[model samples]
Target: MPDTGRSERGAVSAARTRDFARFRHEALLLKALGISKPLIACMAQRAAVTGTSIETEVLASGAIDEEAYYGGLARMAGLPFVAEIPDGMINDGPALDCQLKEPTLVRLHCNGRAPVIALVPKITHIEGLASRVKRSACLGETIVITTPSAIRRAVWKAGGERRGRVAVHGLFQATQPLSARTVVTGDQGFSAGLLISGLLMLLALAPQLLMIILHLILSLFHLGGLMLRLAVLAHTRRHGSEHETMLQSADMALPIYSVMVAIYREAAVVPQLIAALDEIDWPRSRLDIKLVCEADDLETLAAIAKVRPGPHFEVVEVPAMQPRTKPKALTYALAGARGEFITIYDAEDRPHPQQLREAYHRFRLSSDKLACLQSPLVIANGGESWLSAVFALEYAALFRRLLPALGFYRMPLPLGGTSNHFRTAALTGCGG
Candidate 1:
């Protein structure tokens, strides 16, 4: 209460100083390994941008003093310094079980090259290392090595030959270059209008264009049908008092609700899923949340058990079946559900607190024909990369704009994979 704002600013400044010092120390260690200053600068910038700390420890055989290297890096980067060498280094015996426990931004500099690995979580297992390396490849990071055995193994695994004499350090490189062709195309409204106008002009000029005109008219009629459906949906949403009354009646009945989450090999995402469910604003007593897992997925089962959720949290083991996909698993879970209403959420989804309430309101207001109310599903980590950004934008356009427009017109919804709230009776009747 006493100047809290000033204290917060001071804390932030101290954190930044610590970050700068860490970067400098790591850079000096890399220099001792024969990594260039320019490369170190690039790595430092990458690390700074990603908000990750750098650490380097010398092996027992190495002559380089860890403290001196750390200090040199800090001095070069123009930041405050601190260093502590752990008992183990990368070359330590039998690769000790070091956990990369935090979501880290790693900038690797070997020789004169720099590579960046973003949003890498603390890895606990040796098996996870290969997957991490593969993911880094997907992100287009350069791999460089100052150590001979490390480079040899990496090169061999990568199917690259060691050129010339056996050197202590070597570099592997890749980058995700920005491509103009990869950008999503904008709306083609003008071109479509021009095409329609030209067709009309042609029909006006040709008196014997009756057959072509008839075909065009038929096409227009089909389009009009689609438009009419949209119009009906819009009208229903805006003016259907009867619909609202029906939903209200349903709410008055106060039926129980169940939420199903269909998962495959999603052990990594289960923690987040449970966390999201825990944050749901609905009454916990009435909430029956199911974690539908495949029979063979031991990892997911283990992860679920680790959480040790309450009775409301049910772990449903799906039998091995053909077409082992989410929809199939959900179909199986739906058969056993005892709730009046059912909803689906994905492993990575972070649904809004009031989502269930909004869906209930929609149901209570509408007739049975409005069996499903699909809440918009958005990418929570959309800005992580260009691919994710585009994926997020596409979803936003579909769920927020296009789907609503379609619903307004009473057209059949293409049905998104998640956030679909359903009346159990209506869904069962429709063979859902």
Candidate 2:
């Protein structure tokens, strides 16, 4: 009997040694797998040293409590212990009576050396439990838990609270009205009232009459200009080679010409303008293309920035204080002009390639009194819509028929808005 007892004790000692050996091996594996040291330690406490058995419990509310078992396995296998809590656990309360009654589970998802706990409680008492847990855990270090729906509700409540706080602080109120008295003489008051009434009447009637008069004047001017340009073209054809020779000789003396494009809220048409400019036959290096833009216009700024307008392309941000008009912007840009000749193109302009060359030649041959040469603006997209069709016809009569006639007669030419090339010095002389 004595011998048998001694033999049993020896066997038990060997078994203990084997269990320790297995545990050490498992711990080494967990370290190699990047499992956090703290989590591994917690798992080792709950699990059997040798990893022979795993304990699992399904709580009363149908949540599986495999923390102890999985934690241990993770330690042994060197893997993270992740728990996927059911959605219902957060939505529904826990069972009425259980060992861990009203228990809240905190689950966290994380990277690095920290353990994350996301909590799902199965009972009403656990409703506000996460906030308390978060506060306490935050005091130690930090713990992030998933509570999306709860967080959303909290944010909404916070917004309402802020609104209520603002409501309490009412708007400022003036204590008293400002006082001033009018010292009106009888004649002055009567005269003032009569003047105001007259002004109102004029405002009502004057615009229509003014518009009619302006239209009549514009029509007459346009007709006269057109007729003159045509006559000039005819005369030039008859006069011939002398003028052509004079122009070719002048090109050698003049500096490269520059084109100025003024844009404001014109993002839609800018790309088309760029495409047209690119298609022009002029040497790119010789063309100084200035794209003038208002400083405040973001859309146009962004669109223009994306275009890699090679060496000759320059973006000039015009100050807002300048007159808020296309002509004003052009005038401002002209102040910095370096070319011997300059031309203006609107955001939608598509000038003929030969237009610049033609203008340059004309200026070279003509007298300095020909300060400005107005080029005909042909509407390319004329028949696309009713508005366009009318515009096309109007332009055809103005450019093709009338302007040339006006030039021939040497009459004062009211310039077309765009594609009007001028001798740079002449334009600068005309109020820049």
Candidate 3:
């Protein structure tokens, strides 16, 4: 047999050589386009430090906006540059969603010609594309270049209705038992009704005995809840949190972290909400913030448009549907989430600036069984009323202390509605 070890070594060597050749090829092209040697060297260093590509470092650093860089790419390849890809020019399909992730190609029909729109698949391919364009004028006419954002926008618009359907029904359809859509299953409802009716009939016949039995059952349930709380309390006091320091800092290349905010008629707080989102400390290029608003809430949409959040932020308008709740709004927007991990926040919550960083760090350290990290939600208006104060205390005892203990002790952990981070794959696997 052939020497397997030698073959593997040869493959590794060949891969390194190709990487070197591509790096040199891209560097020479950038130099030809008037990029100074010093600037290139700076970006190259930044790329190494972050464990990212020169292209990623360049775009994220704001050295060159997508328009200028992709336009330059179009020019070099002798292809036309499209400022925007019209929704009407493209066709939507089930597989069209693949473009939302990588955005390599989108075929367009314009003026009776099918011109193929593309983003540069790789820097090394530009020379080959330019060569092909020179060899065939027809190929040049058939090809065009555009930014990734343009392609995503076109896909979002084309699939708006479909996305809405998926967002609304995805969870319920995938896993009915997990969905809150139905209050209870038919069998569960029947059992509950039968139990309640039997207890009432027994009370009518033997009031004293029924009362004693009822007291015993209720007391047992109460004691169980009490024990669960105390166990968590004791665990917390003894060990403290494993994430007190927010784990180690993530200097390496970070995956896209998506932040989703579902708002209803809270137009008055739009400015504050946008400001809070802007304060999160993360790379702009890797942050995907989705502001999910109801379709009928024109005021909130108008307010967001007026504020004009960055390109990293996008508005996902969910169609007005039944059970018009925050969770439903969040569920609807999940279809369009483009991130490795995602989190939900309310309109008024000003999350800690380092919250995303901490969440990512914890996820890296934890095992796959760890599906989510629920950030403690503290109530701000506790001092306003006695009722509010009690609620705030409940939140503190449950989230800040109890839940962490429950997880540490391998007990059942219930998640809150907002301020929880989840791995996208795990979330989708559990039907979102």
Candidate 4:
């Protein structure tokens, strides 16, 4: 009690020593394993520049062999190393019953009573999970190191075994939808077909009268819709305001933000997408960026790999299925999102850096009913073409005017495909 300050100082000093010791230990292990000093220095430099773990950067940047890294990790952890995980080594019961493939950062080996985990060396919370997995699985966890690709294969296999081949299918399929929900329904198609058939029959029976009445009704409906849209635009132009003052301070702790980007054949835009994500104001640690790609889109996937996104980014490969739309890709990506808030961006989107912060603050200040935030969409190349200019104007009216008016009136919002931030729970509750 008399020397509490001295004790605290000593504890801090010891913690620093332990941290340095781990670094030195890894370096010595690499050297002892015959890794070159220059390569070791390169790993350290890349880790420093990318804000990723030394082990991960070394592996990703090709400075170290994957097998060597795993072996070295096993030695450092004092655990047995396996060059290859055997077939059925992970018991289907425990693996299927648990979320082994999720988070895309950890892989679970369920062969024994104890769970073996291959986790990202830097990002994984070994201390916190030690008790949790043991309590949940009724087995102690054995931690190891593995690359992201290894875990992806494990997850895909486990899911297929557990949920059938459709487990890997994106949320939408023509044969069977994911749940009670569907992005498009047969009922809608049937109804549309019925309406067209009835209209044709009417035209055949009494063309003159039916055409006149149909035109009148359609014209009125169109006029009313345009008037309502104009009204919203007028209101927006008069009172639209930014939540500039509501922005949080930079010192405030940032919550995890999930960003979903779906790319099919967009190889050329992959670099731009990465650049746009990097430009976000939020810390990389707090940004969970999922680049959703189709399994068959090898070109786009290759482009993404060439970009070499940092630890914050993940590549979610959606198994090819019917109704191959962006929403389908997003639905697949949604299953693995780990964040408090989620948002979407297109292949060419370049949202403001402060967008995430503003959205977070707006949600905090808003009522519980306010579950989503729509960012304004602006076209940067409107001057280049007449069609582009028209598209730009339409977007301006839709995002700025109509959406704001709809929000103000508490009316149902027709959500735009991208830049719409949502509360994660709310989205998942509605079968994201």
Candidate 5:
């Protein structure tokens, strides 16, 4: 009996040795498959010390990309390798619940009425999730392998997008009271009222003196404003003909451009707007084009939908708020902008094709304090009427002459409402 017990102990020790040997063999295989020695060692140590699988350790550490690791596992396991799940294939079913736990790594779907769970290989926790889906979904579950991005996209489609839209995110509040703060200041109206009241009282007390004082004040105000304008105009004329820096092709890789277009009652101009956006010389993938629309503007929304812009284009629906103005609409869209640089475009305006590129090059060349650039605005309808011609000349004077002079002299540059390019950080720093 004692000899029998000894033999049993020996058998148990041998089994333990074989298990350790298999662990070492797998680690060696991973190294042989071109995984770095340090990564293989980490995987082995994690497997032995923390009870984590080798594959899980490598994937979690990002030593190897998901595709290579999972594709290898799928081949070894004789399962299909799926890079991306088709859109609209996974509904909010029990299988979707399985994906929610590790949305970035796992996705569940149905393949020809057969439930399939796609996962990054060697994720120890996903087995139980798969089992739960198999029992509830009723269809036999098959396992496949896919990239991390694919799984994340599937999870986002399952419910994440709706959650993102409804999350409030404080965008509106960040740029709130935009009407009071941006366009028309509250203090301006109050000051105007006080001035008018004081003038009326002065006129009632002494009509001749009041008239003389009013005339003097009006003359000084108009003269000062005119002098300031003239100075800027003179400076602009001096520098107007100087050659702008040529935008190089290599410089294009540096910036992600944000284009914001605020549209209201311009449903008829959506096509033109789209065409103008398409004509921009910047890369489409790097462009963050935001089509800002009012919540109630269904016609514009329908028009945008019909245009069907690429993935980079997003239609931001501004919630109805007080002081509905163009600046307010832009503030609403500014909250969701994702780019290093930002610009505003009006609905009917078609900017020059090289404008964005030129702006980017200028920003790169200028000092850090140079926060904004005003692109020259020209009237396309100048020949249509005398009024249009006059309007064109006015715009040319303001944008081409006055604004550049203001910028050169370090004076406050008033924005031209459109075709204004700004650094995103600088704009947001000034309250979006």
Candidate 6:
């Protein structure tokens, strides 16, 4: 039998053909919108370098707003453009979640007139859609056009209740122990109380002995911790450079890397945040960047929408549930993640461009046991103050020395919150 581990040459050729078609369609779109040839050429080169689509480069380059560009297509196709789709007109459910990932079409149900499909009409299919409308006059009743954002908004409204419930309680329902729904388990609380009471009694009855015993226990605990950190640091220093070259370039078929940022009351951080994220060296088409915001954080949400991000960017709204924490927001949007690898970043984080590629390469080389990789977190503005200097040094020691050391010893690594790369399976298997 032939090998099934990889695509055959014919399959590869067909995929390349599709890429050409995508580029051609995007070129048509650019030309119709009066985009200059020089800019188009520049975008094409950037797309080639990144292994992304021309549309992606154009969108990321900020040459034009996403809605305005789509509106240009609507005008060219002779279809009406809708800035927003009313909630009641569109039926939505969890099944329609695919639309959320790659928003293309939505069926609208009106009161009096015939039902119309609101599509983010592709330039490649403009003629095809128009021909069908021509053949069946009633079909042309209204194949109205809308932006991806509008389609996303309508879908979010349609599946609010179900999606919100899943976001809030899906992990708990799947695996209660893995969830922090109940911060302290009943058994743990009882044990803690018993220990506290015993400690108090000992302290009161035999102060000198209790002090000596407690001091030894505390000292050993810390000593062990320090020894472990130091051991890991030394081990890493020995073999860290062995695979550095191998991790420079990732595999040809790069999996989608989901980058999720949980934003709350950081409206002012949006511009720089987006800019920093865009600096990541990855194909925009295969990147699923979710700017997850709480439902009540309208300011940040509005700021994100105002930017008019490309199709690759999604604005995931987490329900304002109890324990409105960053973890909760991230977990809420986990259901919509469409990547094989997932990573989280803070609004202020500016990760190195090759960080994803480096992590991905290491993951592929390592066995299945290698589930996660933490990118080093460095503070660039450490010279600002004494507090900043200490923070920077702490980060350098923890991320650069301790984390690698722990990994070298094959011990559990406490992942650095930002710039962490993880296998999607590992993440979801542990209840997301």
Tell me the TM-score of model 3: 0.83
Off by over 4 Å in 6: 1-65, 72-79, 112-114, 200-205, 233-243, 246-255, 301-312
- Candidate 3 global CA lDDT score: 0.80
**Runs of candidate 4 exceeding 4 Å displacement:** 1-73, 81-153, 160-208, 237-243
- Show where candidate 3 strays beyond 4 Å: 1-42, 118-124, 207-216, 240-244, 319-323, 381-388
lDDT of 4 by residue, 340-409 (tens): 8999999999888888988998888888877788888899999999999999998887887777788788
1 or 5: which has the higher TM-score? 5
Cα lDDT tens digits, model 2, 1-432, are: 479988999997886676556456555555554555665454443333323211110111112223443344333322333344332222211121121211233433344646444433322222244345445655223332323223222222223323222222211122112111235757988999998897577668897775686689999999996775666567657754233332333222434678899999988877788888877545443466778787688889888877755545557655555345676566555544546789888888888866777787788667887777777778788879999999999887666655555555565556787887888877766444
Candidate 4 lowest-lDDT run of ten:
95-104
What's the ranking of the predictions by lDDT, best on top? 3, 6, 5, 4, 1, 2
Give the Cα error of residue 431 in candidate 2, in Å: 1.4
TM-score: which is higher, 2 or 5? 5
- For each candidate, the alpha-carbon lDDT, in order, equals 0.57, 0.55, 0.80, 0.69, 0.70, 0.80
Candidate 6 contains a number of clashing pairs equal to: 1
How far residue 251's Cα lies from its native spot in candidate 4, in Å, is: 4.9
Query: If scored against the real structure, what TM-score would every candidate get?
Result: 0.44, 0.44, 0.83, 0.68, 0.59, 0.81
Compose the digit string of candidate 3's lDDT tens values, residues 158-259. 776776677678778877787778898999999999999998999899999998998999999999989977887788779986655665554555878899
- How well does model 5 score by local distance difference test? 0.70
lDDT of 5 by residue, 34-93 (tens): 678777765665554334457545654545776777676555545568887787766654
Model 4, residue pairs in steric clash? none
In model 5, which range of ten residues has the least summed lDDT? 161-170
Candidate 3 Cα RMSD (Å) = 6.3
Error of 2 at 129 (Å): 77
Model 3: weakest 10-residue lDDT segment is 243-252
Cα lDDT for residue 12, candidate 5? 78
Instruction: Give the total clashing residue pairs for model 4.
Output: 0
